[model samples]
Target: MKPAHSEFPAPPAQLDHDNCRGVASILSRVGDKWSVLVIMMLFNGPKRFNEIKRLIGSISQRMLTLTLRGLERDGLVTRTVFPTIPPRVDYELTDLGRGLSKPVIALGTWAMDHMEQIEAARAHFDQRNDTA
Candidate 1:
């Protein structure tokens, strides 16, 4: 018979120093609040710079510009410039970016679903701590 824990999946491969550093670096970039918000904004389709800023509401123009440039540099987004009396620029997700969107959206959905429960838990913890 198989061992009791045999049904469980094996753990992931161990990361060497270099691999760990690389993973950490990438996570620091992609895991930031701004980056996640930007990715979600582009998940549906392309949007103009102003449109994205408007959609996200509180993001400053400079921060939005920096976020777009960083995403473009990382190959998760593309910027297109249209020739017109007034120049137009659009940002769209690359295939690699779309791959990231599925997990990000699921995470966002999970957070939204559990927010009430999470808040209640925090309140309970605080109340208990205060009484102690």
Candidate 2:
């Protein structure tokens, strides 16, 4: 007799067009350079807006604001405001955001480990393309 697992056909690996578009949109949000950096910075703990900006060092205030807003909208981040003379605001990863950390970190680790190979591949491709 066939195995029980063989009773069902294997699922398609590729998403249908509509599903693909939806996934692509989410990937674009998460895969953007600034989002990755922001997420990584928050992985340590909560941080104020300026702290995130200072650590990232090159993002504009507008861009940072947009990024944080997007993350908060997506339910990946939480923003808290404190009562004070000037008021203090902080951003932290929510459970959903923390869930994203592992995959993001793995992507970063893989990039770091293979960057040399990627650069070599790029150089080889460029040299070949230049000859052509």
Candidate 3:
């Protein structure tokens, strides 16, 4: 008797388990509120620590430091130092970070355009679930 064969095809080896982890790292980099704002401000070229804080309006020093450190760790932002009477540091986007601006702006615009519809859908879904 002949044995039956399976019909499903296997996936390419390129679809590796690490893909999700890599995506998660990217999302995590751009996903935080401070990270998004910091990158946006860098769109105007490099800025000193206090200058960024002034433009962002109310970000605390600690939070800004943490966010900048994280961005630096991700290789998206660079920190520069100058030797003078007082040390100075400035932050600017790396090529990769600059490339991210278009995507981030697109996402922000989409959210603004569709937020009302999305909220309405969420309310309707919540009401239906409550009635059920």
Candidate 4:
């Protein structure tokens, strides 16, 4: 049994070419694993490029650079250059980027809270399929 709203519409939500393409484009960018992590890291405050890499640990230098560039292009992150002995650069979230943080943090919290349940469900599904 399902509530009225729980059931999908007859044809489901619109999946016209333009709609699908637009959604996929954005999802491909922000929905990437590294993008999410990078966005989360910048939520605290502006961080140097190296600082972000060190904190995120597993991400490679190339990937981080790409992520930052993409975010900057999307107008979600601002890159600042400080004139000093050598040079210094920092990345901070823009207003739009900060707006993105709220939902991302909520999602991260939900994943942490439900991890055990998700793992249990995975195990159950695997066992059932194994026996089939």
Candidate 5:
């Protein structure tokens, strides 16, 4: 007994160029700022929840929870829980997540190399668009 909305519209099994475009749209979900930071932190090794919180500084508890959940759902990150007097949790990048590191690192490098130029372009664009 499945509800209509509950079912997912998966990309068709037939190999097609459009399938690649559809997957790109899906990847955008995990490519946001917080998700990228979470993956970068795990690029070194596995880390505990609090450790990741400290590493990412400014992220609120709620946001960290949400971002981790999304990444986990996408199989980009894995969460482990240990049974003990006090429950413990840890997160790490899966192999797919690790695969994204190179591209993310390249983006970081590009940002560093072009930041000044980008800022200048933004200033010019803003000035050109200003009504006043």
Candidate 6:
């Protein structure tokens, strides 16, 4: 009997033009630095706009607004507004976004673990190239 994982399609060896374009489009969204940071910020739980901005530290107000809107448009996040004396808003990951967190977190951990090795490799490569 085939393994359970066999039910899923294997990674494409070569993507056709349309498939390549689709992959690039999605990567341009989720692979962006700000989007990755925003997704990480929302991974824990809901947070307000200013709170997300504060946590990310260097993102401008306008840029944060745009990032949230893009994530929401992609169905990866949801925005909620509370009716209070002064209105309050919260941003949270959707089910899809939550599903994405596992891989994102794993990738982050892998990067942290391998950072020193990666830097050493880069330095070695640069030294070789510089002296060539």
Mind giving the per-residue lDDT tens digits that candidate 5 earns over 1-132? 965774657656796788888878767866788887888789998999889899999899999999999989988889999897698888988999899877887777788899999999999999989956
What total of clashing residue pairs does each candidate reach?
A: 0, 0, 0, 0, 0, 0
Query: What does candidate 2 score on TM?
Result: 0.86
Question: Which of the numbered candidates is closest to the native, going by highest TM-score?
Answer: 4
TM-scores of the models, in the order given: 0.86, 0.86, 0.75, 0.87, 0.76, 0.86
lDDT of 5 at 110: 85
For model 4 the local lDDT of residue 26 reads 82
Best by lDDT: 2
Question: What tens-digit string does per-residue lDDT give for candidate 3 at 1-132?
Answer: 976556746655685669978877889889888898889889879999999999987799999999999999998899999886699999999998899877777777788899999999999999999999
- Note the Cα lDDT for every prediction shown: 0.90, 0.94, 0.88, 0.92, 0.86, 0.92
Error of 5 at 117 (Å): 1.4
lDDT of 2 by residue, 1-132 (tens): 956798667877877999989988899989999989899999989999999999999999999999999999988899999999799999999999999987898898899999999999999999999999
Model 6 poorest 10 in a row by lDDT: 2-11
C-alpha lDDT (0 to 100) for residue 96 of candidate 3: 87
CA RMSD (A), model 2: 5.2
lDDT string, candidate 1, 29-101, tens digits:
7888888889999999999998899988999999999999999999999999999869999999999999988
Residue 71 error, candidate 6, Å = 0.5
Better of 2 and 5 by TM-score: 2
Question: Model 5, residue 102: displacement in angstroms?
Answer: 1.6
